[model samples]
Structures are given as structure tokens and as C-alpha cells.
Target: MNQENNIVTRLGLCQRIEQLPQVDIGHYPTPLEPCPRLSEALGGPRIYIKREDCSGVAFGGNKIRQLTFTIGEAIHQNADTIVHGATTQSNHCRQAAAVAAQLGLKCYLRLSRDHKSLVQGNLLLDHLAGADVELVDAPFGPELDLVKYALADKLRSDGLRPYVIAAPQSTALAAVAFSWCIAEIHKQQQEMGIEADLIYAGSAGGTQAGLILGSKALGMKLQPVGVAPIYWEDKIDRIRQAANNAAKLLNLDFQIADDEISNTDAYIGQAYGVLTPECIQALKIVAQMEGIFLDPVYTSKAFAGLIDHIRKGKISSDQTVIFLHTGGTPALFAYNQELTDVPI
Candidate 1:
């Protein structure tokens, strides 16, 4: 069958899911495996991990899933240049550059000046991708919108079709991709003879939204728990809405109700980007026990929450807990000082 027809029928299951217009960029069905050691250490139910880190395209991460659809849309829209803004070490920027390179489109990254010196991991890859980096001096609070408007205006005025990859603050397409991930998790779990009781991940809001909708659609009883590394009370709820919206866009009947949306804010320590002691400890434990590397910004902080929940007995000893390894190992190199004495 032709690619168009495959997308239309949503056939080939993994190859084409739900009529998605995606550019084949990242490897699919990222390994979902049982973490025997980590699970045993927690003394809770069985533990599993969705290894998105090994997604196998451009350093791999959860972002690639979303970019498949997003980049395709950009190509479909005839975008010749891709523009995005983020912190110095932005995974989205890295992933966007990889996709743009695959599609032979020009890529430009607008980086915030606040943390430029701490460039490592994804930040290094961002440079390796040879993306035209624009430094913005605007502070973290006011810089985002300023950069957005500036880039959009410049792109429009120059007659260049530029596509901006949505930032962590914007859930537009991120929520959609994660919803697909959640659906896949349900299938993989049933095949393994395991029923997941709870799902945990580091999220800005979009990833959690997708997981919630996907879980609901699968009719799975598992709870989607998002550990926020940033303090945004209503932020995750907005992602839930976006996830439901994405489902609706796909002609699926999924409800993202208030009760179904949930998360814990305990993991957000110090501030948004800074690492904390709990996050540092969680990173080391996961790496040592499971050989999984989580960045301080996202997965590490979220994992801390998972560890706390296990210790507090909020999650029973009989339930299965699955941690979504969103794959920000690139960010590890940037925090060498925090996680010193060994290579991140």
C-alpha cells in the first residue's frame, strides 16, 4: 500500500497509527521492559520502563514521537526553515534540528542567555547539528514571548516558511504524541501478562495529557501520575485538555475529565531548572540499579516522586509501577558539577 493509503487506514499498526502525518524520523515501539532491580529495590509491585532514550533516532527521546507528526506537518505546509527557542540545553531544539536535517530544511535555534554557560548534553548536540543559534538576553520570565514574536515576525517578513517547534510551555503536539505512547504501553503490558497500576513521568504537561487520554481509551485502570519539576498548578490540567483535543482531532471519543487528571508537585525542588538533592539521589539510584540515565530537569525529578510514593506506601506493594524514561541523557553532561566525581 502507498504511504498515503496506509496513513488513511491507520494500518500496519506500529508503522502508521491513527492516520498520523508523520515523517519517519525516530524508531518506534521503544523497548518496554521490566526493571527487576529497581522494582525489587522499591519493594512495591513490579516495575517497568518505557525506554524512549533508545528510540534510535537523533539521540532518541520522547520528543521524537511528537516531532514525527509535527515535522511532517511542517513539510506538508511547505516550510523551508524551522525556528524554535529554548534554554541552552533544549531537547526539543536538538530533536527539531535532527528532523530538519533529515528533511533537508534549514534549522535555527533561539537560545535564552540566562543559562548559556551551562551548555552541555543536548546543548552540545544542538551545536553539532549546526543550527543557526540566536542568543536572546531576555530573562526567563519575559524572554519566551519576546523571542516567539521576534522570530515569527522575521520569518514572515523574509518570506521564509518557518515552523516553530512548540516549547515545553506549549503542549499543542506534545500531548498528541504522548497519547500514542500511552496506547502502545497498554498493548505492550497486556502482551507481557502484566497490568500496569500506575504510570509516572517527568512532564511539563503535554506528555501527561497524552498518557491520560491513551490510558482512558485503552480502558486501562492505571493512573497517570505526572511529577512536575516546575510549579504550575493548572499547567498539567491544560495538557489534559490538549490531549483530549488531540483525540478529538483524530476522530476518537476520549474524555479528559478533572478527576482523571492527576500529578504531584513534591518533586519540583529549588526552582524550575536547578537540581536538588532528591533529584540527584534519584538519578544515581536509577543509573546504578537499572542503568538508566535521567536528567535533573525532567526524569530524575519525576523519579524522585516515584521513589517517595513507594516509600510513603501511597502505591501499594502489589501494584505495578511503570516509569516513562523520557530520555534526556544529553542534559546530564551539562550538569557535571552537580553530579560530580563521575562522568554523566
Candidate 2:
């Protein structure tokens, strides 16, 4: 992919993406702003944040991008209800509920119970958006997925059309959505006259998958580094498959190779939704330095990984890095008890 070829391919990519059924949900072309103070504090590479936080719709987040296509498909199918599941504080579920409300569709969210389960943060917003919420015994991922499917079935039995948002097909669509996000980032990079060497985000799935697909498709030299918020043994393989699925949707010619996937589970301390000491420190540091808030469950952990790399001198000072702020600031409120002692 030379410069001319990259330009041509990106144009084609944008066209194909536009061809997909989508709803106007999130604010597009999210700002890629320089984090000068954050970079100076880290004493590392030049840092910028892709503000998916400011992506609009129910306080914004990465899920809004995915939901734009996912719910669009629901509307295309004439779905009357949207079913989704994840952990209690899941930004995905929060955004899903909000999007459903915006489009005048009913939403049912089955959230997995966790130690930090509270009627605050995303859960509060979930209810406020008029989503029928249930906190179940199941854990996030496959177990919770089954619950969502059952709910969809029940909805169908009740003579309603339900669309399961976390279904395999919808997950693939999410990856495609994120690939489009990568295209957005690429355009921003070109306009800024700077190219990122690496892009970091909290990922256990499609968000990272799309990053990989988009970077590969655009022939960008940058690597999409996924800092896992949860441990998944087959995360690498899952990301590859998701990326390939997205590529197929976009009519791209390449498949994502295993070697091309870069993800680390080292930052997921204890378990999913458990805040680590490093994560707490990361939240405080970013807030104090940049006046930006990173949610405890995801972005903070990933940012901790980035900070670890910087302090360990893993990234060169000259390299430009983009931290994808996938938004979950609302979760900050839910973690108030835990964050109470952390000094700024």
C-alpha cells in the first residue's frame, strides 16, 4: 500500500461503509486532540486522545459507534425491541439502551451481577433511558449472551420483534463499525499532518478488531494495540476472526493474520470490573493532568498499560501515540467508594 494506493483504497472503503444501513446516532468524526500535558507528564511519546467520550448520545462511548450500525440493522429488520447483555457497568449496554430510546424502540438489558453492582453509573442511565433492566447471575460474554437470546425468544413469543444486539451477526457489524472509526482516525491523522505509530484502546472484542481491520485495509504503518479489560484465552483468535468478518462485510480483499493482532491482557488485574491500584493511579493522573476522566472498568486499565510502557521506556519519545478514549466517565460515579481514597 503506497501513498497513492492508500488514498484510493480509503476512498473505496468509505464508499462501501456508507452503503451499509446506518442510523444517525453518534456525532461523527470525533476529535483527535493533542494531550500535551499528559505527554509531558508521562515523559514519553507525543500523546493524543481520540475522544470517543464526546461522541454524543447518552454521554457517549465506543459502543455508540457500534450501536449506530447494530440498531440500524434492527430498524432494517423492523425490530420492535432491542436485547443486549453485558456486565452491570457496561458502557455498551448503557449506550444500547440510550440508542434504542432515541429511535423509539423498546430495550431490554440483562446485565451480569458483579461485586460493584449498583443502581448507579451506566445502570442508572439504563433505567433513565426506559430500558427494562435485569441484573442476572450470569457473567458477561457467553453466559450472558445466552440470557439475551432467551429474552429475545420470549419477546418473540409475546408477539414482538426483538433484535439481540450482542448476537454473532450484530457483533460482526460492530467490528465493521469500528473499522469505519479507524477510517475516521486516518482522515484526522492526514489532516493534522501527523501519523500515529500506535493506537491504544480497551478491548475485549470488536473495538480492537475494527482497529486492526481498518489499519490493515488502509495500509497504515500504525499498530492497533489492544489493552484487554478482561482476560480471554482466545482473544487474539477472536479479534482476528472479527476483523476478517468485518473485512468481508466491507468487501476488503485481505484477511487479518494472527501476527497482525496485538493485544495484551496484562493490565486486567484480578478480574473484569475490578479496579487495580495502577488503574486508580491512572485515573487520578489523567484527571489531574489533563482534566479528562477515564472510567475505572476499562479505559483506566488500558491507560495504565500505556503508562507502564512509557515509564518502562518501551515506546520511543519521537513516536506519536493515540489513546482511544472510548468513554465511560459515568462509571466514575459508581466507583466512588473505591476512588474515595485516591489522591489527585
Candidate 3:
């Protein structure tokens, strides 16, 4: 619609979000820092990094944004424990554990046995945050979610109220949280006197969903490109559903269509959590050029895709782009063997 209408719509969405149960966890309006060196190196668009890594939670990451609502819902339900599951190096679990500790609730993380032998990265932080960590036989997606559900049920049997962060309701809340993140970015973009042409992030679901929903809601022209770090057959559908679910939650009239979602599975490499050569190079370049660290598993892969697009002339120099750094720098320590061979 018109500019005035767009502003009113965004404000209404924010009002609806504020009415929902939420906890104050992450540092808000994370700095939208310019990446001039990175832009120069690519010889591409003016680039900025949305410092979600500087979110000021445990070690900070995108999960902190989602956890504010997830954990808040847990507290609202009078949950004494929070149950979550993912890969061993899961940034979400690490942040969840920290938020749980901050809110004085017990946290149980049932991570897949992938990389279970090493306690270097997120798993180490999970423990440090006092979460009861368990390495399970399940894989990182649906299988791990089932394990979390069972754990939640068992907790209830023990007369303890437990909230599963991966539940459908909680995931929807996460999408709503990220939609608010879009609002923050829009305000920051206005302050900086430039509108971003594209926003890039590593996404399997909620983050991208929120980006799409938020853009549609605000009538912003920028496109959010989600570079998948993991392969999922229903990923696009999942994102669409999440956005729609979030819209419903906010009592919004619009829906996210399949055509509105932009994502790519090309950068995922061999599989989830498996680092590729491109990822290593991207990580090293960003670190050396901008003094920014991207985790091996997620952001590195997405940034690699962005770099490739710039090199291929897919993204023009005149455009402004924002790379969402969904922090997992701690995971860098976990990949010591893989990263040791790569030159700086």
C-alpha cells in the first residue's frame, strides 16, 4: 500500500507482538555495521553485517532472538524445565541453555550424537550454562524433535513441568520474533539513509520465514535470500507454513506464498554440519578482511554463497546488501581439525 499504510501495518504488527508473552533476553536492535572491507574485496554491492552475533546472550547468536519468545512461553506456562534438541554443535541449544539459566529454569538439551565426541563448541557452552546435556542416537531434525517430545513427556511424568522449545507452537513464536527483527532492520536502514536490496542469512526455517513475512508486512522491496546449511525436502514448505503461522498468530491478514520465499540448498555442501572448501575460504576471508568470524556450519556457507553471487555478477555493485550474522563463532573451536589445514 502507501507509505503511511505500511507504517501503520508495521506498528500494528509490533503491537500484537508486544502483547504476546516474551522475556527480555537478547540485546535488541543489534548493530547494523558496515562491511566496507568485505564489499571492496568482493568488488560488489555495499555490504553490511547485521550483528546477530553481538546479540549479547551467552556468546550471542540468532537463536537468542527466538529464545526470548520460546523461553517466555515456557515461563508463562509455569514450566520448571526447558527441553530442546538439535545437532551437537547447535547454537540454538547453547543459547537456550544460557537463557534457561538466566530465567532460573532447568534446561535439558538432547543433542544428536553428531560430533558428540568433541565438547569444544556449543556443547561445551551448553554444559557451562548448566544444561543437562545428552547425546542421543537420533539425527538433527525430526528424529531429534521426537526425542525432545519424549523427554518432555517423561519430565511431566516426574511431576515436573517441561516446555519443549521445538514444539510447533514454539517454532511459530520464533517466526514472530524474527519478524520483529525485520522491523528493527527497517528502522536501522532508514537511519542509515539506505534501503537494502537483499538480506542474506543461513536458514533452515523460522529465520527466513520471519524475514519474508516481515518484508511483506512492511511492503519493503528488499528480498531475503536464505542459503540452506542443511538439506530438507520440505524446507520451502516449512518456511511458508511458518510465516503463515506467524501471521495468524499476529492476527494479520496476509499470507506468505511459495513464490515469495527465496532460498537455496546449493551451499549446504556434503551435508549438515559438514564444512566445505568454499565455507573455509569464506570464513577466512571475512575474518582477515573485516575481523569478523563466521561459524563453520552455518553463516560461513551462506556467506560463501553471497561471495559466489557477487563474483558471478549476480549482485551488482550499486545495490546495498545485509548479511545476517547468526553467530556460532564458538563452533569454530569444534572444527579445529578441519580448520587447521586452511591458510589464513
Candidate 4:
């Protein structure tokens, strides 16, 4: 951490986001509560869960923090409509649509034909929000950049001022939201007398970048280990670059060096959206032990990574670990078939 940069200089994304005329849509300082059961299970460190899952949207998850900024950008651009490209169980899409509805913007969702159903979880919430749905049978690629470009083109043809909530692949805005979150975590830890040696969370990469930049900016002592639930090692660099840009947005003068960012591809399991047994077992243990529900796609996988770290002694019992509950609770329902035999 740079001592000179740590001075109370009015620099970084916090300054930039504060400059924006923003509205209050989500709750703040989400509970940083202890998880006794999970801590005991880890057998080494005192484990705490940052309850972003209780963010209180249609179904709360960590996306609310990011959505706050994303929607603010949409409003800033004076977009009358909201457009997004998402997976079938995308919590981002659900929260984006919810924000669009609350802001009185026409919401357009483009999903892959790979969707399994419409009855449960995030897809149901998308319908409940009354978003205009476009199902791209096979022409749409899974890459968000492609979907964003296609949606932008379609919106232009239809004569609507559409705002694609620029995914992390496109901009630093999403990570900027989580950077603010890291600031909050720093404050919360001091208030609670807790020192986290390791912080684990699901990463498409941007979230980790934001956490790392914010921690570095505030000069907090913790390792921001990004457990990649997707296979995009190359994008981690882009994510860090986005964090630097986000730091510029916040007016913070800190830089994220290549060595500062740590990511693990092992947590991803078979592939994106495919649930592994490790994830399944971890999810069940957390729920049964602490009565906390983690969605299969994101949080469970991250938790699995944390557990592996504990088992491998990468993190010791003397250390304190914080697992970020980057809210994907809605996606849990979408994976209902996988959880059928698992007890509540």
C-alpha cells in the first residue's frame, strides 16, 4: 500500500460516484455478521460472511451494489429504456430489470435459448418485472460484449434511447460499485474488531478488482482472492485495468499492479453454470449449519473455494476470513432440479 496515496486526498471512484446525483434504491452497509457454524467447519480461522444476499431487491444478492451505480449511469445517460444480455439465470438481469421498473424505464432482456424454464427463480422475476423478452435461439453468443452490441443495434433500429448496463467486460462501472463496498467493509471491520486475512468472493473478475483496488486505496490489510467461477484468465487483466479506470473515476490515485490480483480457475468446476459436487456439498453444509441459502451458480462455488483453501491450509485457523456473499440467491431457484433431494 502506498502511504502517500493513502492520505486523505480527494481522489478515486468514491469522489466520482459521489459527484453523480444518485438515488437510493438499495440498502447500504449490509450486515457483516459472524458465521459460527461455518467458522467451526473451517477448523482454523474465525469465518465471517458479508451478507450482501440480504440486499433486499426482488430477491437480494450482491448485484444491488453494482446495480445502484449501473442504474445511475442509465439515468445519467437519460435512457428511457434499459437493455441487457444475460444468462438464463442471470441475477444481474433480474436486478437490472427490477431497477428499470422502479425507475420507470422500459426493460428489454435478451436471453439464450438454453433457458430451462420460466417457473422459478430469476427468469420468473424478469417476467414479474414485465421486461420485454427476446430469446436468441442460437445466433446470440454468450459473451456479454456481443450481446451488448446486438442489443444496442436493435435499440437503435427501434428508436429507443437504450442503456445497456455495461457489463464488466465493457466498463469499470460495475466494479466501481463494489469498490465502494470495500470501503464499507473496511469501516465495518474496524467497528467490529475483526481483521480479515483473506476475503473470498465470486469473480467474473471485476468484483475482485474493485475489492482489491478499494482495499489498496483505503490501505486495509487483507488478501482479496478472486475465485473465478468462469474460465476467463485473460479477462482478469482487463478487469484490473477496469479497476484502474474505476480508480480514476473515483479520483483515487492508486494503481493495481499485476501481482496484486490473485485468481483461481479451480473453483469454476466443469464449466460456467455447471454445478460441481464440491459446490453442492458446500452449499448444503452452509445452509444446514448456518441456515443461509447460497445460490448454486455463484456464491456456492466461491464458498467451495474458501473451503478448499481452509482444507489445504492456504488459510490457517489463526487467520480471519471473510467470504463475500455476492448475492445470487435468485439463481438458486433456477437450479431447483439439482437441489431436489437436498434437504432444507
Query: What is the TM-score of each predicted model, taking all chains together?
Result: 0.90, 0.96, 0.96, 0.91
* Superior candidate under TM-score, 3 versus 4: 3
What is the lDDT, from 0 to 100, of the residue 108 in candidate 4?
A: 86
Question: Cα RMSD for candidate 1?
Answer: 5.0
For residues 1-344, what per-residue lDDT tens digits would candidate 3 score against the true structure? 13443533667778988988889998998999999998998899999999999999998999898888888888888899999988888888899999999989999999888654488888899989999999989977788888998989999999999988874676677789889999898888888888899999999799989888888788887789999998889888889889989988888887888999889999998888888999999999999999999999999999999999999998999999999999999999989889878775
Q: Report the lDDT of model 2 for residue 174.
A: 74
Cand. 1 TM to true fold:
0.90
The per-prediction tally of clashing pairs is: 1, 0, 0, 10
Instruction: Give the per-residue Cα lDDT of candidate 2 at 98.
Output: 90
Candidate 3 Cα lDDT to native: 0.88
Report the backbone clash tally of model 3.
0
What tens-digit string does per-residue lDDT give for candidate 1 at 241-308?
77767766566654677777777778898788788888888898888998878877899899989999
- Give candidate 4 regions above 4 Å deviation: 1-16, 115-118, 138-148, 168-171, 341-344
Q: In candidate 2, residue 196 scores what lDDT?
A: 90
**Which tens-of-lDDT digit does each residue in 298-335 have in candidate 2?**
99999999999998888989999999999999999999
Alpha-carbon shift of residue 66 in model 4 (angstroms): 1.1
Candidate 1 stretches with Cα past 4 Å from truth are: 1-17, 140-143, 167-170, 341-344
The order of the candidates by lDDT, greatest first, is: 3, 2, 4, 1
